[model samples]
Target: MKNNKPDQQLASRRNFIKGSALAAAGFFIVPRHVLGGPGFIAPSDRLRVASIGVGGMGAGDVRGIFSSGKVDMIALCDVDDTRAKQSREAHPKANYYKDYRIMLEKEEKNIDAVSVSTPDHMHAVQALMAMKMGKHVYVQKPMSHDIYEARMLTEAAEKYKVVTQMGNQGSSGDGVRQMVEWYNAGLIGEATKVWTWTNRPVWPQGIPWPSTPIAPPADLDWDLWLGTAPYKDYVGNLVPFNWRGWWDYGTGALGDMACHIMEPPFRVLGLGYPSSAECSVGSVYVGEFQRGYFPDSCPPSSHITLRFERPGKEELEFHWMDGGIQPTRPEELGPNEMMGDGGNGVIIEGTKGKMMCSTYGANPQLLPTSRTKDVSLPQTEYRVPGGSSGHYNNWVEACIAGHGSEEFKKLSSPFSVAGPLTESVLMGNLAIRSYDYRIPRTGSDNQFDYPGRGIKLVWDGANMKITNFDPANQFVKRTYREGYSL
Candidate 1:
């Protein structure tokens, strides 16, 4: 008797991955039942994967996933062919597409996971779509462009029972865990003040949007590239990297580097959302007569303060400075000692002592260089096998092992941890953006009232809202474009 059921044929089609003949024929799969049943995936079974925005950071992510030796990258997508050219040449067999939606639809049966490394504005939408289709996701840091989106993805991961990881590689580093061990060992007493800074926005910020109306590059799909953001004329430099300086397409320096700098303190202090947030942005001189007020772009530099209510102690005061601004030298440091790894660093001031670390939570040290060498603490946390670079393989193996497996729980920056951290990080930007919100003063054509200035915005973490300032609430969640809804 000849037997050929449709479901069996589909399963057969979905089960043959990584063969010269199969790939050359544009078919990829993992022999479903041959490896193992249900939760037990075999060592030889390769997870089929896809990537969106395979250029720049996207290209790095895809390459890392492929390097893990646990997955077969079957599809690659990007809006700009020029940007994706390198990746295409590297993985010519993996189907390439300019439209992610079409790629997902056509390859749904073959893909086991998706990596999203697009612009801040598009991350949530792309990841959300993949999650809805029961695909595991690895998203880049800051979780999302909005606090609401972060919360949604956090909840969705649990709802869909899909393994998830955020691309804050530092969260998996030895430095952060070592700091956590030190903090838990009471080496640094109750943390009362923390400061973090970076020299970012090497791109232009705090200026009017480029008014030049020019055609977009032939290789770039301007409409698709602007996914989730409002339609606008093409501007040079904004597409490749300068977008980080704009509010509409990016989240400024906070989004650019805070996830890397702040993860250590967020983990060691065991902090959550701040009770109140405030900031002071550096001003730019637009014309000789009046100061510039460009809401379209981020400020040239800024200093922000976030207050958290500690369960048993006084409130914690955390400061964030960017655009090369740094705190005064700590007395514990030597005159020649560089503060915070130079250019970017973090300082945690505790009731009894202080600790500091450089970017990516690397090269941690105690104040007064002598203390760093003198003190020793137990390694209380499990060290990530490959350290920071192991971040990609960590997620890939987990997806292969199946969601809710023991291996899955060991992920470094799962949505569970990343969501609150992202929400808290984005909180600082809310304060910075609010500083620019204004209204015209009544009966005065010559004057304007800045409503968001000079106030501490009280936050309701549970609801993701700004209880004190109504206007600032808008940033907690944004209105997406018509086609892209979360």
Candidate 2:
């Protein structure tokens, strides 16, 4: 009664006693088996994680994070029980919920990190919420649904001082690192052009939205699944997959694969935002005389050209072809050789020589292909453990190490890097969407003129605006539904 002591000191003593009792009883503590292996990490050193969208790609993400053995899977959230079955069965002990907001509210003190693997439209909202809470976040590719969202997430990461990673595993692969070393060593001098191609849209695109609506599955919460996206009636085949082709819910083929295919060139050349963008898209035929125009759906194919300005150097030309289109084969490559992993790949042209690689920067090769075997350079880039496969653990360990730690700096696709790359990828979409922009003909009710077509869009990256085409600016950011905000 007479002694005066700080509340913190008294609380510390109480915590010590409580911790000791829990350790002795093995209750309210990590199991001994979980921390007893040869390289066991203490419970205090482990990262406690909660995952949203635990199904489809989300299930794989969950497995990858848990495989690290340096994390505790504390909670799981998903809108569809059917899609969440695999992860739920795999982590039976973790708390499960349908709404991520409720899960975060109740478990905020329990989770140290969050993994977001939802559709393209939902990525930014889920990730922003976690980062605002000072929790580390690992979000799937493209990082966001819009350019403005990408920019915001990038800035928020720094403001909150939280660890972050984008789910582009290829960024951590040995192939990209090797390419970096080669470029730094001048294997290909002064890159002037880059070509990236992917045969995606494996789902339906260049088509009209389904006319009839159907009831959502019994276990699926359709409203929750449409988080951040404008409300629409349930359409069959749009769930579990196939959302990639819709402008409302997905970012189309460019968003699906460019992050993997174009990353090598972006990293190798140290490229920034593009100064301009233009594109041409393939059209579908509705009848013998009519060209089908479904503005809401992504086209079947597109060829986008983006130009980047370098103050002291020649402007760089970047090409992106999707839906089976590819650049002309380099003369140095053999006629019969496969190009870009046979479906997706990248080629960089330089003033002196050229190099190429498939998606995820895998199988990098000099133009001749033969040069890849003969040319060698010292490895200047530090390799992440397990290469691309170890991407999940890299983030897990980094989160455990905390922000500003050495491990955090080593993250392959942190928001600082992934953010710009995502912006560039989304730029291609902006051009594609602009190519489809239409205006009602001066006096006609049905006929329309496509003014956004046949025009190159001038981009002001700093302000995230399209200076030449005001209509295209609408695509830079989207208005969220009533309850969702960045």
Candidate 3:
């Protein structure tokens, strides 16, 4: 698909030249205070940012980026006025618009960077547009809605030569870095099995879509809110939240939390795409004994296993559980001890020992808990300033420094790394969706048959295809609405 319009193409070329010129002459440029007022910041010293979906997590992202004291939030965009109110009130000097497309078009030259905190489905389209315009991007976690979008965004970052960061803040945390060091020192040995769990679906899932639609709120531009997703009538409770359960918009539990919970293992193990995927999902009982079938919504609970091939080592078995499901606890812990912060956590079992951590890789501990106190390892990985809290400023500084600079190299979750990780996370979702793939039975006692159940789907990660089941490949990519493309 053509990624840019004629005007956008011109703007992209102009922006590229402008960025190149600024990078070339940055060292020689005079201080802004010398040229203007004492409070003025030089173009090279400040990052002018525009934020899309400036509400919910987006509001926090805006606050974090602005707190860097080196960012000028020049533009803000959101489809809902009520949701954008907080950012608008906070950044009164910034321009505001409901449509991101118009904001990008009008303010293209003014923005040096863009932050996209939209839903999973719209992430690729919004971020791609900014990247094509030579704007550095900080996208929210589960970088894209599908495997294809993730791969495309990964390639685009390199092609555009822009500094990029994904919103999995844990990647920048000291805990993850500490875990990496310990793992490198053979503390956990060679990890063979990894388990991650979450108590999500804090929204709702495994239920049928609302039978009736309601009018969208007066403050909301419902059409714009449904950007890349298929057009659907406004439904109650879907605006501010609750969209996470629907397949049309959100990516369910796996997409919601796996990026945060799975990153430590993914980074420590130097993992790549999975070689195979399979899953078993919890079903809801409808009235009495009948099982609920709602393909349009994510299942209420699920247990997914993915296998990653290692060149010289045994294949790694990675397990993900959601809807309060958890793996069997290691016997090394006391019966009363909490496993993974009581709600969400990760455990990596290796030949020698096991290590565990809570969400975002916080509070990392070795198995038996006592081993964590005496063991020490040299710090091999660079920790981001302020740890996880420094994630926003890290990207801001990197953008100001320009791509390929030293600061850029220190990025925690650039698309190059986030893309593969996100793809792996979404692989679990693929297995879940495939598990619900139903077929009509011909001249049989059963009304419907599920061939995908109880079968391991062989994956060709490079090709983004499920080799064993052709039907499962349908979830790898999706058709966007009429006005959007990626």
Quick one: best lDDT, which candidate?
A: 3
- lDDT string, candidate 2, 109-146, tens digits: 99999999999999999999999999999999989989
Models sorted by lDDT, best on top: 3, 2, 1
Write down the lDDT that model 1 would get: 0.89
Query: lDDT of each model, Cα atoms only?
Result: 0.89, 0.93, 0.94
Candidate 3's TM-score reads: 0.92
- List ranges where model 2 is wrong by over 4 Å: 1-37
CA error at residue 297 for candidate 2, angstroms: 0.7
Instruction: For candidate 1, write residues 268-302 as lDDT tens digits.
Output: 98888889999999999967977888988999999
Q: In model 3, how many backbone clashes occur?
A: 0
- The global Cα lDDT (0 to 1) of model 3 is 0.94
* Residues forming the 10-long window of minimal summed lDDT in candidate 3: 24-33
- Most TM-score-accurate candidate: 2
In angstroms, give how far residue 442 of model 2 lies from its true place: 1.6
